[model samples]
Target chain A: MEIYNYMGYELIEKIRSKEITIQEVIQQTYERIEETEELLHSFVYLSKERALKRAKNLDAQLKNGKTTGKVLGLPIGVKDLICIKDSPTTCGSKILEEYRPPYNATVIDYLIEREGAISVGRTNMDEFAMGSSTENSSYGPTYNPWDLERVPGGSSGGSSSCVASGQTPISLGSDTGGSIRCPAAYCGIVGIKPTYGRVSRYGLVSYANSLDQIGPLGRCVYDVALILEIIAGYDPLDSTTVDIGVDEYTKELNRSIEKKTLGIPKEFFGEGLQKDVKEKVKKSINKLEGLGANVVDLSFPHLEYTIPTYYLIAMSEASSNLERYDGLRYGKMSDDLKGDVYEVFSRTRGERFGSEVRRRIILGTYTLSAGYYDMFYIKALKVRTLIKKDFQNAFEQCDAIVCPTMPTTAFKIGELVDDPLQMYLMDVLTCPVNLAGLPGLSIPCDYDNKGLPIGFQIIGNYFDEKTILNIGYQLEQELNIYRKIPPLTIRGN
Target chain B: MSKKEELSKETIEHISKLALLDLTEEEKEKLSKQLGDILNYFKKLDDLDTTNVKPTTHPIDGLKNVFREDIPGESLSNEEATKNAQHKKDGYFKAPRILKE
Candidate 1:
């Protein structure tokens, strides 16, 4: 049996049936990692010895007639931003490169307790989850498995790359703008940004607190659904976590989209979108309509401002959130302190932060500074409310909003390296959901002529992830676009 | 798209100081140019009317007490916390003394 080609659900079945031991699965995963990691550069830290130890414990439990939960013995790749006890959670920043977390994140606890999931390792990410492509990671950029020269998307890029290359069946990523979805789109994997507060964000190492959400990225919708079911719930620890009962997402996998109404927001596909992406999105929509969904034209006039509004709010929050890293409490400190208290702090920060992080921090500080607060930060917040209101009004007319996940397919690595603003613009289609606190899913829709994957994004009303998944599942069954794997073995370039 | 404001080298130094950043002359010039472009972009926001709109801090409404309870939560040991520090001594973060009375 070709183990790497199997989905997480299939692997779970094998474990339950005793056809293969969980340890064997883990060994095979490590074998694949060792074989391909040189070209892929997906992981920042691999906990092979620790992961095998966890797998053995799980195996003993299952042998004794005890099953931890649905995702028993599944190998899960965690993004470095999510704190895992005893493992390094660098968030791809050099300042905290060697810092090992002392506590597991709430989601990590959930995965460990209820699912018995083995956290194989921590994957790389953009520095402090700040950039659009993983190229910004201090370690190195994780290359696209599809085309080695192309980039796997950013922030969550390492996680997405691991899943795409079959190094792990599933992974966890945090979305603060399009960090999760963009990488998923670029890598041709399934990524879901669960409704804000649906998944606890207690130990996520805050990038932008309001925008940051821990979500699942997997090869199949069911796998993502299973992970979400395990990790999402009300946590008093996280007051933003709603008191809503967690839904059985796996059960909703087969939910039909018959008679379902889908809204295609026209503004998403109009300008700045590539022709190839437009064609693929149209084909996917047609395929969805063919599968009994009623596609309608939807308008959110305020959509044009999603990018600007998102940057302002995200940078402002990031500026405040990052202040805690001021040499005294957490992260690194420089030794060149020859000045007063304030000057010492300045010197420490000046030496620690990277260029992009410093840029955002300064911009955010200026916006939040005394005289400019009302002009930049406050106005952006007002616009954010209007953006949410736009989605609320649109959802009232349609069940979900469908659009292209990104303007174009994955651009070549180093293409936008010099232009920070241009790279930021790639997240234009995705930031609105975070602004509105809505749920969105990015699924593989089609591939461009070059065989690079194109993704279609479906956003739902707050806490309506099941409906979005249902539509995605329906389309998945009809189109089956994920069957085409990129020809990485042949080119080897 | 309005009148482009050229930031003086001295003003760049001042902003960098306020931002707690120590930049070289070359870095200062490059950043000053990039920051000027970004600040100009933000100027576009001036056209919007935010007459009485309250700034939205947390995305969710009624965001109160998002902190986890302090019930013997796991914390980093002094050793672990100071392990990544460039300089440390005796399980504590070491820094140059600041106050000279």
Candidate 2:
């Protein structure tokens, strides 16, 4: 039987039934990783010994009849930005080439301790999760599993690619302005960006702290829901995390989406969206309506300003959050400094961070600088208040907002490399959700004539993750469109 | 386009210096051009009716500060602190000799 076709629940049941061993599953996972990793470049770091040891322990526990969690023995891929104990948390940058954390992130702890999930490896990402494309990684860009010449959408590109390719059934990814969903969309998988504070950010290397959130990516909606259950919760280490009660996400999967309302915001489908993406998303919306969802035309007038507002606020937060990576503290040190403390600091930073990171830092610093503060940073904050208010108004009228996850599908790796602004604009549709701190999900809606998968985005009110996933599940049953398999380049079988 | 926000090489150097990044002359020139282009684009917003539009800082609901207990908590020991340091001496990192003659 193709056990990989099953959801987290069935996969766990098979392990318990003696039909499969965690060791066998993990070996399959590693074999797949080894097969596809060269083309996908999904991983920044892989721990063969650690993963095998964990698998062996899980197998022993199963043999002893000690199954204790939902994701028993499932192998998961982790984005590099989230720290895993003793693993190199490079954040896709060369500066932290040797930096290893003394502790696991709260999510890592949750996945390993509370839930018995084995980690396959750390996935590659954009440097500091700054860019929309995985091409910005200092290690090298991870290619889309669907097409080797194309990018796996980023900065969670690696996570999405690994999941899509079946290297792992599920993976953890962080979303700040479409990092998770965009890549998931491009790679033809399900990706969710939970409401801000829904998942603890304690051990996540900060990108845009306030907007950044940790979520999951999978080939299907059920797996996405199960993984979210494992990782979502409050952590005392992170004050930003809310102390919310965890829900049985898998149970919500069975909830019917008969009478739920889905709002299709007009502004999102405006110009600049590729025609192929529009058709796929529109057809999916119509299908959901056919399946009993009350599809309504909605207006989020401020949607056009989402990208600019997101950039200002995100860059500002990124500027401050990344300030701690001075060579004197962590990361690579510079040897060319000949004078004072200032020289040491400058030389170290210049040599360490990539051009993209430095550009953002400079832009952020300038915006927050003495004279520009009131005009830029403070102004952007006020706009953020308005953006959040827009979501609030929309949620009052509907249960969820549906849109395209990205303006277009994944492009050639070098297509937008020289034009950062164009790359930044690719995150237009999804950034607003991060700005509003709302829950959002991206699911494969259809494959275009060219055979590339297009994703439809569904967003919900704060803490309304269940509604979005239910809608996604219902739509999945109707469309039965899950074509984002890792191409032969990355699939071991 | 008016070049009001044009960044000079010296200014780029100054920003780089402030940012603690070492840049070769070639990189500085390239970054200067790129930064100039980006700033020029954002300059369009300066022409908008943003006088009434508030700048967005964060996208979350409410703004209440949550504070931790004042009780003392576990701290990292010096051994643990210096365990990963590439350079250290006498419980401190040793830098270049810096006594002015």
Candidate 3:
């Protein structure tokens, strides 16, 4: 019954072979959630009735010799941002606390219909996907399953923590900047931020339109690859999705990384990067070199400019995108609607939205406001072009780029929650990838001396997720970190 | 780094208004300092010379004006669309008064 620790693919095969019924997996999933949710607090809403119904249906269909679909009989924890039909999809904000989405996100449609994935629940996240740690959530921070005192890097912290703690075998998360990768690194799991136009973003609550992407997170490269292949591809519903074909990611995962060139960005190893993270990442590079991949030193000259460039661009878009949230439709409303529309809008947002959400919106409005737009927003945009060019040059000399997914391991839960500037700075390593709209994967490389996980980031050229995935898949065979489970799960069970 | 980035209290007031958020005195006071520091941090972008470099609005190239056949598609029903509304009347998302009395 402790099948929670099994890989997603293994669970699917076990169900397919009749070694275990789908009911057993579903029962175990809820049981795991029930056991640890008090401390982990990873899930915001548990979809018990609906998930059980789907599990029973899938079990019946299996008995009838009609298979569901590459399926996971196990649960997949969906981030609160992605809409699920009639499901409470609050992006960890109280503003939309009362609202339930009427339709499923395209990824949800694909996940349920194409892959037979069950939703254990909607995972927790930073409110409006604004913070680096999951502490900004209205429901409360999702404690790091590895170290309860520490954070699970967010805004996908809940998704990452759930997988790490064995509450779910896999989870889906959206990354605008470092939401997915940071948590993956912190919680010792695998996560991908696919190219911007690679996956459908429809029904995902937009934080920043241009920067946001929905991706998969799991305990291993294979779990992530399997989920990515299922959710990827063009859908007419999401025009931002590319018409290009998605690779056979799970099939293409086992290819050798021999002769592949990896670029190590010199800027990534510079100041403020923790000593432990640097050493662990450097050791990972040597492992890759020993595995037949070539490692080359490179520099992204405009790298430091990325923080400002990313924030300026992201905040401006967030301000514009969030304009639709007025009291009248889809969320908690003000009691007094007698005031003018502006009063109503302002009061609702002020009362409902959390502090971090307010700060982003306020700063976002300032950057886009008169007299400042050219100096801040426009300048940031042009610098975005230069950052893109930097990656373009690096990719020419190397097949992929590797760096520490985060500058440091997961800090204590309350460590960086205050000091907004400090929290924003934590995203320096990951946001630059979003600026270029490239595919980036974070795999557990090595552990710091503190017994915390360190994530190794493999960033790929646009639309080239397969190479990075293959590299991660191959690297794990040598390091063998995926099979390791966090002690927290064992203790909790 | 030539000059410190600072947000004037009045400017923060104006921004809060533009963003349409009613603010507490504490929020304005806190944001005035926090945002100024962030804007100061953002000043790092000025060091780069982006002369003639086109801004990347969206990362992918040749990804605009996606043309599909003009046709009616399955759209959300009125009830479904109004389902999440805080205030709805007659299958419509009812809103607060736009004009002051």
A195-235 per-residue lDDT for model 3 (tens digits)? 99889999999999899999999988998998899889898
State candidate 1's DockQ.
0.49
TM-score for chain A of every candidate model?
Answer: 0.97, 0.96, 0.98
Backbone clash pairs for candidate 1 read none
Q: CA lDDT, every prediction?
A: 0.84, 0.81, 0.89
Candidate 2 per-residue lDDT, tens place, A1-493, comes to 4545565566777887879898988887788788768878899889889989988988888788776766888888899989887788899997787788877899988987678988888899999998887998999999887778888899999998888887888899999999999999998999999988899998899988889999999888988888888788877888877787978877887787788888877999999999989987898889888888787787887776666678877887877787777665456667675777666667777777888898888878767777777766776666667677778888888899999998888788899888888888898899888888899999988876666779899998888798899889888888886643555442221
Between prediction 2 and prediction 3, which has the larger TM-score? 3
Candidate 3, what DockQ? 0.81
Residue A333, candidate 1: Cα error in Å is: 2.5
Instruction: Pull out the clashing pairs in model 3.
Output: none
Candidate 1 scores a chain A TM-score of 0.97
Error of 1 at A62 (Å): 1.9
Query: Per-residue lDDT for B1-101 in model 2, tens only?
Result: 34467778988777665556668898778878877777666554444355576555445546457887799988877766665566678877656445553
The DockQ-derived docking category for candidate 1 is acceptable
Best by DockQ: 3
Model 3 CA deviation exceeding 4 Å by range: A489-493
